[model samples]
Target: MNKVLISADHVITGPADRVITRGAVLVEGGSITAVGTAAELDTSVEPEVPRLACPGATLLPGLIDCHVHLAFDAGPDPLRAVAEADPGELATAMADRAEQMLAAGVTTVRDLGDRDALTVTLRDAIAAGTATGPRVLAATAPLTSHGGHCGFLGGEVTTDDEIRARIARNAEQGADLIKVMASGGALTPGGPRMWQPQFTRDQLRLIVDEAARYGLGVAAHAHGTDTIEHCVTAGVRTLEHCSWRTAEGIVYDPPTARRIVENDIAVCRCVSGDWRLFLEQMGPERAEAMAGVIRDMRKEGVRFIAGTDAGVPGARFGDYVGMLEFFSSLDFSHAEILDMATVHAAHALGLTDTGTIAPGMRADLIVVDGNPLESLDSLRAIRHVLTAGRPIGM
Candidate 1:
């Protein structure tokens, strides 16, 4: 196995309990063999091995975006774009988006929805090293109620049997995870209200039960309070959009929050950085209230995983800087911001490996030019990206 040494002024090891400091990492055969002080490794190894040195720079695990829709173009009318474009066009566009994401220091991503299951094909291509892109966990299609949000992508079911059939088909098609739209969405024109529960409790339960039977994790898109509770009760592995709403104003029940904490169900906030569009759609008062609720949820002991709902209107891939800034606006410390995008985000997708820089893990890493600890915005200053120990062509 050929070895490479990378030395940096600061290494933010994403592993738990690791302190940030100056260090060097030894990579051999696409796995990190050692990480320690530069003096420590240099004194022990041969003097002639080439070393890529980056003084005053910070090295950390590559970032992960857990919620994305590669089929949508993140434009004014993303669904309409998907509806108009052919499969080949969408695939090529998705490949471009994936490369852009890698250049932004995102090494792994989870695509929650796609049309015609093209995400699976792209994922396979990237994994085979035939394409330059991030490691992908693709959801074949999101399950939804008839005429519900994103139902156009297929996988709508009216009965438990139909739900099982859809799950089987997704598994047969090589999906990495299962996604379900438990509530209506704002993007789907004339769809059910965003706060309305789209599926019956029984139907949701059956989906979860069957998905578990196949060793597959599920991410439920739930915005309403009732739907969030229903998804939790059904043992959903991950909850997306978790933006709760009700008829009598927004509800924030402490018991329900505690249940999510106890059940260890990861929650993705799916925050958006399009301040103008959000203000226009929600008005100033409602938008402020929604933002406040998200902050409160974080305070109430609910685990918040970072995801930008990329490919939604105005939410572009490789633009996670907006999400980091959003978290900063919420008063999250720099450490918290990085954790949400790195280690915590990986756990939300049921991915145990490839989140951190460590021995015996996949060599998916990013090299930045500045200290992200000093300024989260430095993430955009990507210098190099490596997947499986091979440099990604920019």
Candidate 2:
């Protein structure tokens, strides 16, 4: 069971976009040991070794979604749904959502926010084999100001003491990273406006420093222009949304953006599968403007990793490839887009083991029916998925 040979019509061994026709990957002890042509690898393996042959399919490193919320259901009133659900019932549903994403070829997902710090329990369950799901990097409870966005999740902090205490508790609970609500959010009704900063500049800096002490990075949720600028100054590891919103409209700041590139800060737009409706929510003109700014910032060397913000009103657990398809409209190559979901995303999340199909990397990979290099739509044709060398059922 420790040795597996996965052969496919095409294998994408990446950090770069290299494709090998009739390729095979050898995985042993949950890590990739060899990758080459099917013929080359087949002859080298013993006849007793298990071989999973996938004809007319493309194999690539498993996809990663940089942001999602497992607490809410993708319904008109996910907040209400969360409030009403039984705690035990909610935990079961959240585990189901994580597995749903795994079936769609997403092998890893960063859970940014959830009620009751439930995501941390889910993460441990998956790792301990009591549950089946993607490798979840959970932010147990996102730090927020009193009456700020997503405060109901119990991460409210008005003083520096409160902030430090929250981080300490989350770290003790085995949180993979720290999430901070740097700005407001639309989903939280009684919270700050979507463009308002939730924490003072110094407070935000303190959060980042405190997280670093625990060997964790901070993912700041910022949508406002000023708030995005502040996150940059605070030296967060990643910026969620980075929407650059203002009362005037979505604004782009070149100076702050330049620093983002120079400092190697990653940006997660959290663009979900509901692209059309999401754009509609922003209005056509504003949507176009946001798209334009994303394009401009890409040119300016800003790195955007993939995230669906799943569990929102229209975002689904299995719709991660749809998010990648949206990026095609943004003028990125299929290879570049795939990298965003794989290598770029893993790096952004500080994950080193699962992003590439190479020696010493985890055997987290997927086989789709068609070549994704030709059309990203082929990504949806998931035929098989491997999470650390073990085949997972769809």
Candidate 3:
């Protein structure tokens, strides 16, 4: 462990807390040991500690992305890119993407899909200091029907034996969580329709229980109404892209929404930086309808976890601030949106130590040129990013 003193013009300790002016934090043993006015820390910290000062910047907890795909290229044809690349090359590319995320001030990410647990290897590499990347929580390969969405990644099961075996295998591979594609997805050509269910109610329950055997939470990639209902009943810890999709348009099922709120299942809406482009592609009327649904869900006590679905088509690892800005379309204030990315997302992912910049918290912090509480665009002016007290390579 190393010691470092970080001082900034302003520091945001939590989303709800008032900004601390002339703030300084002491990092020791990869954790924050002190947080207060820079003047107080100037005398309290040992003289041997190295100090880094940002005279006109705001310091805050590092951003967290709840859903990302380290395997895809974020290109016009992400599937083709993954399909065409060699295994070793794909892993190398994945490492590069993680570094991109790091440079963008994303300190933690939950990688929901990758081929052959490549993210697991990358996670370990980053942890061991052999690679430069964000702290990764990998889902390895998302569970799906034999030919369902993202089946090419190799998580496919049809029978009870196969399902249990795969879950066990994922646990063995050190997956932080289990990801199940509960419904069809646009990314998988020839797969079931987006509104179609991939698993029966009984099968969904089985997957949840099997993952629980390993003390792992299950995150479901659910889009349709019925499947979202199924996921809620099955106790999924997180719901990815719960758009309430149907054949004609988006549907807002009030009762299911209530259940999701009551059960406290965090929703990752999967909006990316190119949301405005998507809005144009989806048409204004549909976009308005979806926005209404999002607002209603928030009103019903559903706060979203920030996710870029990065590496999907048109979603880049470098524009996470853009994704948070998209939340404004749903009428969330800058403060509310900031919580969704930091403290709220940390809780959603069961990581309690890394979200807020407070004493005893992990030293995962970022400093930017302007106050993010006022304008999220300030996040784009990243001055520094540190994970576990070590400054990341920009």
lDDT of each: 0.82, 0.91, 0.92
Q: How many clashes show up per model?
A: 0, 0, 0
Candidate 1 structure lDDT: 0.82
Displacement of the residue 114 alpha carbon in candidate 1, Å: 0.7
Ranking 1 against 3 by lDDT, winner: 3
Report the lDDT tens digits of candidate 2 across residue range 1-394. 5898889999999854788999999989778999999999999988888899999899999999999999989898887898899999999999999889999999999999887679989988888878988999999889998988888788999999999999999999888999999999988889999899999899999999999999999999999999999999999999998989987888889999999999899999888788977888778888889898899889999998999999988998899988988889888999989989999999999998988889899989999998999988899899999888768973
What would the TM-scores of all predictions be?
0.96, 0.97, 0.97
Superposed Cα deviation of residue 183, candidate 3 (Å)? 0.6
Tell me the lDDT of model 1 at 318. 77
Candidate 2, residue 304: how far the Cα is off, in Å: 1.0
Number of clashes in model 3?
0
lDDT of 1 by residue, 107-186 (tens): 88889998888999999999898888889998888998888899888877777788999999888888888899999888
lDDT of 1 at 342: 82
**Model 3 pairs whose backbones collide:** none
Better of 1 and 3 by TM-score: 3
Q: After TM-score superposition, what is the CA distance of residue 262 in candidate 2 from its true location, in Å? A: 1.2
